[model samples]
Target: MKAPSTHPIKPATSIPALLKTAFVNALIALVLFSLMIGIRTEAGSSGQLTYWTRFGDLASIVAAVFGGSIVIELLRQWIGPTGAEKLVPPAVQSGISFIGRYLAPALLIFTLLVPVMFYNQRYILDLAILVLTYVMLGWGLNVVVGLAGLLDLGYVAFYAVGAYSYGLLATNFGWSFWICLPLAGILAAFWGVLLGFPVLRLRGDYLAIVTLAFGEIIRLVIINWQDLTGGPNGVSGIPRPSFFGIPLDNSDDGLAARLGIEYSPTHRIVFLFYLILALALLTNWATIRLRRLPIGRAWEALREDEVACRALGINTTTTKLTAFATGAMFGGFAGAFFATRQGFISPESFTFQESALVLAIVVLGGMGSQLGVALAALAMIGGFELFRSLESYRMLVFGMAMVLIMIWRPRGLIGHRAPTVYLTKAQAISSDLVKEGHG
Candidate 1:
């Protein structure tokens, strides 16, 4: 006869416990929303503050939060921790994996066709350009924060450096955009190296703080240095990028005139769209290629465990510097493109917010995931415009969406860590198996 187990079976959570948790959560929501959502504040004509209450809206939000809390708790208890994977059937997981394999190539094809399909819609083209710009930025930062596992909060410094480099060279020396582009990238890489040297020994929170200070320092220097950087007013009259050496303007040498087509200003928009698309493609290609190389493998190892990387005799210093330089070079390219696109350069354009947004794309997409970053950029940027009609509630909705995504997919949209190198066949290493790096 078999002996029965002596261990007690775990008890399910009681209804009262669930309600208590919900009530506590609702109370916290009430306190937090009381001032921000419940009350509307404005400055009166006489310089005094005026206020109004929206207790109806406040009560509705609190009640919803309470209900949501209970539902979440119930779901959590049902799923348990290890049950998350089991929730999705094996067939569904196989389908998702199959879709992921083709998703990148399909996305690329769609992006290439965007300008052609939306040739007449100027707004769509412009929005596509904006999305592609962020896509490039996200890919560039992905090298550092994603693959290398380095937390960078001052990436905008490189962006500003690139923009200013192109602006000054073109404006002062009368150099063409093509001539200044490489120079801007080089200068930004140099700055990246400088940043790498100082923070060589720093990691985690310390690294983030130092990088943030570096970005603020660069911004402040641009603001205070009126002679060279033009101070806060920034530099204007920056030349636009040309198709080859020919301009996109209305002159006889303009692209439209040369092509014997009417100059409708849409030509310039389409050209800019293609230009950014090409740059973004180049960024994606280069990143993908580098991931298969030895240095790329080093970055992955470093990300997994710095101690293990050192024990394996990899030079962490060079790895970190190369990651920064490579990432910065791409950022510089995007920044130079931005300066030309806008026909102006300003410190205000490269703010901390830009860095945050790019970082968010990288994180939300999946760290070290090229396709994930691109998709995230599209969602965050294009989705923002989609909610324009929501007005004041747009940000709230956006935030709620992000929160829900985090709750469901904490590792990101595509959290799988595909092995850079594998025997027999390359398979994605589960995120749970990968260490997120020390730095």
Candidate 2:
């Protein structure tokens, strides 16, 4: 009787427990959604579902899952130790306790990414290659526009030079891509220096105008130089990439046939993917190396203050040339890859829009950061891919996204963090232990 009196009859309400239940339910719903997709086509006695219908069903399931997850997430507002504190997660439930924290995000990414791998389009991979190429272009141009504070509108001119250079050598002289690639970069650099010479006396908007004029001039020359550039018809059948002198075509038991891999447009695309990946990586590595060096620092200084950079005994002329040359070289690199990838070239490939996009990437990525540019490229180019189905409306949607990102994170993703800089001591220690990365 005394023990019975000590007990108070009341409903046990645990908010944290409630939240956990909601989270679990949401996860179950997501799993169910995946299962729905895996088994929907096999369902009997149901209306036939096409791709769009299945897509709609999957989307509905996803929405349901998200709705449940949101309820659990809203409970996060009560994240302290108080009347409801016990109902909340304890101390973040660190380590294994918060396993879902990491897995949930990864699952979301995989759900989105895995769909594309099966989209059965070569251009999706091509799109990846294109983004990587532009990322390289943006990084290279960041050195000039972001670091050196020089607005180069003629950046694409060097690209045209590089592409045509590769195209001509590889086709006419029968040069290998290996030899033509460096030559393309060198030729682009030479053009960069040439462009730099006259623009040395210019600055700011005036410099940009001059560079813009130069780019137009180069394109016009290419279009008019029919004797050399094949005129408006441009160059075609320029040759595809070869693997160790083995062409990736059916003619020489090219990649697919020889390797016992089915011949599809993607094999060559995959090769291009790796090649461009290597080039983008090389450009990133070189940029990082240059940043820690005196010249790289000098470029940054020039970006911050041209007068001060000059006062510090740094040659503004040489720095500007180096920036232009470096940026142009990367553009040239992209142009060469483009030429090789398409096996064709025309004035259309080198345009002000290309220059503008690259510049926007650097600006959006926060001028001096490599990772920033990469993110910007992903946002711009990748966004285009994501909305490829949008067709005509894609540009509008893309512009809106950029505006939103600028509104939210103006300094750009990762913002002026440095090509390689330290924040916390722990980060520094861990960074050394783990290798420096672009991320």
Which regions of candidate 2 deviate over 4 angstroms?
1-120, 257-262, 419-439
lDDT of 2 at 16: 78
lDDT of 1 at 356: 92
Q: Please, what's the RMSD in Å of model 1?
A: 4.1
Tens digits of per-residue lDDT for model 1, 155-214: 999989999999999999999988898899999999999999989689999998998888
> Which one is best on lDDT?
1
In the order shown, the candidates' Cα RMSDs to the true structure are 4.1, 14.1
Please identify model 1 stretches exceeding 4 Å from their true place. 1-15, 33-90
Q: How would you encode candidate 2's per-residue C-alpha lDDT over 138-211 as one tens digit per residue?
A: 88888788767788877789889999999988889989888899999999999999989987787778888999
TM-score of each: 0.91, 0.69
Q: Cα miss at 219, model 1 (Å)?
A: 1.1
The lDDT per prediction is 0.89, 0.75
Number of backbone collisions per candidate: 0, 1
